[model samples]
Target: MLTAKEIDEQLSILQETGRKISECFSSFGSRMDFKPSPEKWSARQVLHHLTDSEIVLAYRLRTLLSENQPKLKAFNQNNWSATLAPEQEELPLMKSCFEANRNLTIRLLKKIPASLWEKKGVHEEAGEMRTYDLVVRNTSHCLRHLEQLQKLTEASQAVKL
Candidate 1:
């Protein structure tokens, strides 16, 4: 179980990922579409994924806070990514959506009774997870993708428009 302070801190870090991602996108420009390897994601695709993930996590967090052990639905990220159109650069919009959704989620989380952090949910794939666990997992998830975005920007020179 995570302490309230710890959860708050994680939320802060998660919120910061949006700012860092935005910066990475701005720095990389057209190279946001660059793939370090054939199988890897481009920065733009990662941003889209983050925006989509945040949207889902927002609902999951809300449901965990408000409902009894809601079963969280899982979606195919690969399928989502295939449709994200990474070639179309819309970094600012994607970053804004990610940040705003995370902000709303943090506000909601902050207001909930600390005891509710123990609320249980069954993930479609991961089996049972507590509210605290979900938040922690997603916090790390955000950090991982943020690092990916950074790596994509640093390793691949931004292509000229």
Candidate 2:
């Protein structure tokens, strides 16, 4: 089990994720909405998805920490990306929203006792999920989107050459 301090450190990293993503795609602002294919999501869409995910995950985490055997809802990310029309939103706004939402989560986590980390919740899709699972999943989720954005950037760079 990860200690509270360790978890806090991880939370801090999560808080900075938006800033890192913003810097990584600063040059791609003009083309942040560019999708290499009809099936692919652009950097802007990814940011919007991430911001929305943070909001959902924050609520999920709070449920696990405060409730016993909470049943979490499942969301189809692709549906959100499609309906949200993220391509029309400003990139910085999406990134800033992600950072702000994540900060709220981190602040809440800092207040919870370490023992609460073991509390379990029932996710509609993933079945059993512990508080610790949420933390690990959050980190991986952000990293996965970051990797996707990186690939998108590389593809655009190739086209520029």
Candidate 3:
């Protein structure tokens, strides 16, 4: 369960992380390939993954805030990452999607009633999680990816010199 204040804080952190991610993408000198690593996603793929996750999670937040505890569907992130076409390295597209979704998430969090924060949803694997917890987790997910992107950028820069 989260108070409105806590939700607001999480929203702030999410928005800040989104901004940092955009900055990171903008800093890249050349378009990175989709096949940088066999096991790991390339920078472009990572951005695409984040965009997809943001869109899906934003919808989930809306549903959780608007309706009774709904049975949320789970997704296979690895499969999605592998299947999504990485034909273009569109940083602007990724940044726009992230910004729009994050703004919507912040607005939704602000609108959700404090009492409803404790509403429970059944995740396929994680079992039951409170709506607030889900939102918090989603924000944390963005931060984690942002960190990964930063590390990738640093590693690439190191290889240049």
Q: Rate the local accuracy (lDDT) of all candidates.
A: 0.79, 0.80, 0.74
- Where does model 2 exceed 4 Å of error? 4-9, 24-27
lDDT: which is higher, 2 or 3? 2
Clashing residue pair totals per candidate (backbone < 3 A): 0, 0, 0
lDDT of 3 by residue, 6-85 (tens): 86787688778877866766776573543345787777877888888888887776676667767778888888876777
Better of 2 and 3 by TM-score: 2
Clashing pairs in model 3?
none
lDDT of 1 by residue, 1-161 (tens): 66868777766876677567656657776576788888998777887887899899998888877788789999899998887675574677777887789788878877887788889999999989988888888878888987787777777854333
Any idea what lDDT model 1 has?
A: 0.79
- The positional error of residue 33 in candidate 3, measured at the CA in angstroms, is 2.9
Residue 74, model 3, lDDT: 81
Per lDDT, the best of the predicted structures is: 2
lDDT of the structure predicted as candidate 3? 0.74
Pairs of residues clashing in candidate 2: none
Q: Model 2's lDDT to the true fold?
A: 0.80
| Model 1, residue 47: C-alpha shift (Å) | 0.6
